[model samples]
Target: MTKFIIALAYKLETSIKYKRFKEFTYNLLENNSYPYKKHFDTAMIFLVLSTIGILIFEVNHKNLRILNDYELFAVIIFVIEYIGRLWISSDMHKIILDDYEKYQLLNKKYKITKSIKKIISKKVDFILSPMAIVDLLAILPYYRPLRLLRILLIFRLFKILRYANSLKEFLQVFKERKFELFTLGLLYITVVFFSSTVIFLYEGPEGVNPNIVDFFDAVYWSIITISTVGYGDVTPITIEGKLVTLVLVVSSFLVIAFGTSIITTGLSDRMEIIKENRVQSETSKMQDFVIVCGFGMMGRYFCEELLSIGKKFIIIDNDKEIVNSAKSLNYLAIHSDATNMQTLEMMGINKGANSVVALTNDDAVNLSIVLSARAINENIKIISRVNNGNSRKKFDIAGVNQTIIFNDVAAFVASEYLGQPVAFEAIDGILLNKDFDVIIDEVEILDNSKILGKDINLVDFKNYNLTLLGIINLSNMNNFIFNPTNINYTVQKDDILIIIGFKASISQLKSDLINLDFRV
Candidate 1:
């Protein structure tokens, strides 16, 4: 039953829709695996059920006497949760593993327990602190009627949500735009205070309710008029008050509009800075990275594949705004034309990079980049994207290791629509290289082989799915024999066979055909 309850709790935490809720539950579970998450989950269930039971009791007031016992039960459950937190906190020595480091090598039992204590002790305060206060408040019912405030106990849910990315973004916006928001808030306060004070002084003597005759009323009126939400409960009846109201209303509108424009502009600039920082930071940390010349649809897919394999790369585009947008996601991007020699240098082409993938939409620009990169580092591999078949030959000669023809791919896709699966297969075979597997192996003839004098065909090839394409005879000083017929093929000691087949079948065939006597 305990195990079942634990499974249900794990599912609830992991499967929660709210990112904040999920993060909260995950942290709680990770931090205090022994009992913290279980205790919290149990406590919450009890609180929710008790609150609902109380509400039902309130609805049927005549039967409130019957439900009187639940109030104490609810309080007891909360107190137990609170005590459990304290007890778990006190067991700090058991949870921490670091204390073991302080002991001498021979004292294994002492060190282990000490480490456990240290880990638990360090985290105890974090688990018990604000949450304990919330737990305490949740169960304290001052009055049966005032039990509605117990609903505010649900605000504890905010603690979990506060760690969410959305909340972090919200907090970050305020942190980044602190001065601007602070200035706006100050102005709003001043407008409210002054307008309310004037109206209070002006409207007080005219028999308008003195209790509502303060600066707050005038401030309320100002907000309503400025926002155009005029609730109409309060009004400036006196001539002096009316004059003040007129000035306040017009000035308030102007201030609001001006403030909004300033704030919006400030936020946009901050966001841009954030994006640029993201890109620079992301790129600066990458090593042996591929520098992609564009971030178009094809370039994006290429980047995604590199990222999937955990390979590092950076993007370069001509648009500053586009580059900055990529930066905000913490992706490395440079805003520059790929064809420029200076742009290539700036991307560290001369050092610290393995390859460059030119993906510009412009064919001529991509060709120029390939030529420029080859001149900079002839050893650097260049993959150039070509839009048409006409440019493939020229790009290949310009030292482009691979040239992708976008049009050819598009033609194949179009052929698929026309019901040509063979064309699709051919396209896939060319692009993905799916037809055959290339295996490079150094095979040495063993003394136990049966076909020492016999031709190569005497060795069974069909059973192993093997095809011997060539041989390198070390005895004749590393001469390569390509497609040698069975009569010419003679098994010699230390002969290396280069073969191709399906990868698995090739492994089995190699094992059957050759055995290494010794490996250096």
Candidate 2:
């Protein structure tokens, strides 16, 4: 039976109509970058709000019978959405086919039953997930009775949480801190139950103070007192009752303070996560961004220079305040330890990070960052700050491309990177002295560069007053054609051109390279 079902699923997946429909549905509901996803989300949001608004009106205001069709339509759409989420949550045909292929490769019989079980488990996992649960609850109102209507309608209102990213983030903050909140809740429940029981026993109809008529009344009084919302309706007259009331009042302060602290901590954590996520997304979009692994005075100055030069970079620091300060200037900075391997991975050192700059105060931390970044990407350029002269060799041994220290000089820009010999001292002297009009820089030949498919000698470097230092092919990192006079040294994509010239000349050269005419 499972074999037959798998075969049918394979056939369905192979059908072009089914494939196209599934692809479109998945893109509409699941793809963040899909152009029409915003439209789908907006429509869903409007439908949810409109249906909920109608439900509200049915409860109190005059009947708007004409809008009943829209409410029914919304419920149907909610049902479709729930099924769509379940469908896209896993590809059953792919799972079965993959398992079958793996078994064939392993020279073992295919476990058809096992693959069937896996598909069921995947579907069950999605159904049990929080968002799926919300989707189900939103649809449940359609099947519910009028008296139970409002309760289920609230869940339909919560349907907006799926369409809204901010509300999901807000929900995530509390979800991450559930354990702490749960611990506090246990304390609260204990106090409320104990006080309610005692007050009921002391001030019930049997007691001299009979204002607390029953257990229900005592429970109400307990909640009001503990929250410090005192009402004269259920006053405690007896001495025992008064003592319990005093204890409840004091307990409210502790609970309120503790809860406030927990929420504040969660918010801080969520904000940090949001900032890191933003940096990660930016890295995925940018191919040649630098990772600066410190935000100290030196690090800050280095980043400032990078910004002034129009270079893309992200900042990593253990200091929360420093990260916040960097963010204030609209820099892509994350509060993270640069020495951690996982943190370096998060910053995309292995992906497309062009280089890493470690400018931390501590020599050991800087060395650790160098080692971590090198471990992730051996070819990635790493420059570390060496405050102590003795620690310079340690950084070199860890495969740092360069070591720099800032005394009165603010920053170090590496002119020589990964053994492509452009004089470091010359560039350093230019920036440090701030007296030289000449500056050394590098420009990468992109796929769309005007000079691509042309010989290296085509564009006259002397015309721009820019000396062609060398061209490093990114693919062949070990090879550098220094001052290549060869006619065949053609301009190609991913070639880094190191040159020395004025800033304006370099910028103009870059602009020309991408445009149709780079002939200077």
The digit string of per-residue lDDT tens for model 2 on 294-362 reads 898888888877886779998989998988899999999888889999988877787768999999889
lDDT, model 1, position 516 = 32
Model 2 spans with C-alpha error above 4 angstroms: 6-47, 57-73, 88-131, 143-151, 160-183, 206-211, 237-240, 265-271, 281-287, 294-301, 317-330, 335-345, 349-439, 442-520
Worst 10 residues of 1 by lDDT: 91-100
Residues 1-520 of candidate 1: C-alpha lDDT, one tens digit per residue = 4345334434544553744643454556333322255466555565555666666557657646546666566667557655545544433322332233334355754434344455565566655566555555565543446746656545444434222323434456666677877888888778777877777877865467553566566667778876767777877777887888788878778778877787677667566545544454445445699989988889878987677546788788887877766667666787778788877765667766789999978899899999999998999989989997898999988999988999898887887858977877765574456344544444566666545555776666565666677888878978998866445688787776676556677666556554532111
Judged by whole-model lDDT over C-alpha atoms, candidate 2 comes out at 0.82
Candidate 2 lDDT trough over 10 residues, lowest sum? 408-417
Give the best candidate by TM-score. Answer: 2
